[model samples]
Target chain A: MARASLREDIVNAAVEQFHMFGFTAAGVKDITDAAGAPKGSFYNHFESKEALAVIALERYGATRGLAALGDTSVPPLARLRWHFEALRDENLAYGFSRGCLIGDLATEIADHSEVVRKAVQDSMQQWCDALSGTIAEAQQAGEVTKALEADTIARFVLSAWEGALVSARSDKSAKSFEAFFTVVFGVVLR
Target chain B: MARASLREDIVNAAVEQFHMFGFTAAGVKDITDAAGAPKGSFYNHFESKEALAVIALERYGATRGLAALGDTSVPPLARLRWHFEALRDENLAYGFSRGCLIGDLATEIADHSEVVRKAVQDSMQQWCDALSGTIAEAQQAGEVTKALEADTIARFVLSAWEGALVSARSDKSAKSFEAFFTVVFGVVLR
Candidate 1:
């Protein structure tokens, strides 16, 4: 029981550390320190930092609250807005110090680590799929324009949000988020 | 003359190093070695890696071909497409190994380094200003929708391109770029 608990703790700490400091900057020692475990014990649970990072990306994707996009209880457009609004609020709550972990990993370490690259790709595909499904529903209901493919819009929206996070992190302001909302919701989807 | 040339070499190499390996993962030795200069000579030209990064960002911004946006000879929308096409082609030529230096630095080191944060903000603002000008011209020529403000569209487009680069790097393909072009040019801008 203790061994399994320690492993879980390491994974949790890794998610936090990788999100905050990025994959290359954060070390096993930092993760273990945050987990209150011995640094040497990191090897017992994971084969390498690369392995741990893949797990961290998976945890991040799972916790991203993406299921809200498919709730079907609310209007599709409203559900989409709520989803991004929740993300924007989270960034603001953290003072914009933490950008999206998937984006951070994709930009910083994806080129170097094939495993990490695949993990980020999988996460992106999953996100694109979720957004695409919601968008198609919206299109069918005439809430969104059918002038373009839902999948294309989904991937573009994902990119815009990712880019907005990067801008928000740099400017430490809500200006980028505002731009994203105004253009994406006000114009593109409409 | 040698000293001046070495300083330029270091700045150029720092830009390449930061873009390829990122800020935290890259070090002074790597930049100096790439510049073919002695590692000890790094401090003689720049106060710290952070300072070098600011100068490198300036160099990157200056070379981004933003001036093309203001050239009145061609149609504004055509100029805009050409700018992004050049960037996309560059990414493909490099095998998508190097993402945008500004986006990479903005995500990786902007929060930790105030100087770099300002530099990245400046680069973003510069890019935004250039795009906003071109977009406004496109709107004036009836080439783009004027429903959303030009600056908002500009910032959103910037974010989308940055996000697309992140996607392209992770997927090692042009699909993200294709989505970006399709949505921005085919739908949003239209």
Candidate 2:
């Protein structure tokens, strides 16, 4: 159990380090130091930094509040909006310094590392699948247009949100998020 | 003239290096080595890697074929689609290995370097401005809905494209581009 705790600590620190310094810039030593573990022990916990990033990406996805989309108490569209709203609020809380780790990895590391790329692909696919279910519910409820497939719309919406987060990070403002809310909800979903 | 060529070569190589390896992963020595220039000459051409990144970003923006968005010969909406198609084809040509450098930088370096962040902001702003102009023309031609401001729609479209590129890179597929075309044209602009 103590060993498992150490492993958990390394992953927690890795998520933050990768989010802050990116995959290549944030060395294993940095992650170990942040986790308060000895540098040599990093190898015992994970095969390599790339392997740890896969774990980190999964951890990040679990915290994305995807469960909100599955809540039966709220209208589907509202649940969808709340899900993105929560994501936007979190990014804003970081002052736009930390965009989505999945997105960050997708842009920076996906090209070079097949392992990380597959992890990102899986993470986004899981998110899109959840969103597709909610969007289908909204379509059935007559709350959203059925002009497009739920899966297609979900993918595009997720992509737009990812892009908006990148813009928000670059501009250091929430204007992109507002635009996302406007067009995604007002125009696309309408 | 020879000296000027060396300076230009460093900028060109920096663009490719950054696109492939990202900002933090690609060192100054790597960029200089790729340019076939001496590592020691790197300081003579640029003040810092961040400074070189700004220039590299500008060079990258120039290659994005934004001029196609302004060709008066084509209908404004067609021009807009063609602009994105060109970008998509370029990414396909690279086998989904290289995405838009601006987006790559925005996600990876924007938070860490204000100089690179400003450069990314300017590049996206310029692209958005051009897209806004094209979208406005489409609105005036009664091809696109005028319910939303042209600038807002332009920003949203650009963000969607950026996100799609990230997805395309991660998935190693063109499905996101197809989704972008379908939604951005079929739904949002409709």
Each predicted model: what fraction of the native A–B Cα contacts (within 8 Å) does it retain?
A: 0.85, 0.79
DockQ for every model comes to 0.84, 0.84
Q: Candidate 2 on A55-137: residue-level lDDT in tens?
A: 99999999998888999899999999999999999998999888999988988888888899999999999999999999999
User: After superposing candidate 1, which stretches have Cα over 4 Å from the reference?
Assistant: A1-3, B1-3
For residues B76-145, write the lDDT of model 2, one tens digit per residue: 9999988988898999999988788998898888888999999999999999999999999999999999
Error of 1 at B51 (Å): 0.5
lDDT of 1 by residue, A13-108 (tens): 999998888888898999999999999898988999999999999999997778999999999999889989999999999998879999999999
lDDT of 2 at B13: 91
Top model number, lDDT: 1
Tens digit per residue, CA lDDT, model 1, B1-190: 4576999999999989998899987899999999999999999889999999999999999988999989999999999999999999999999988889999999998878899999999999999999999999999999998888899889889999999999898899898899999988987787
TM-score of chain A of 1: 0.98
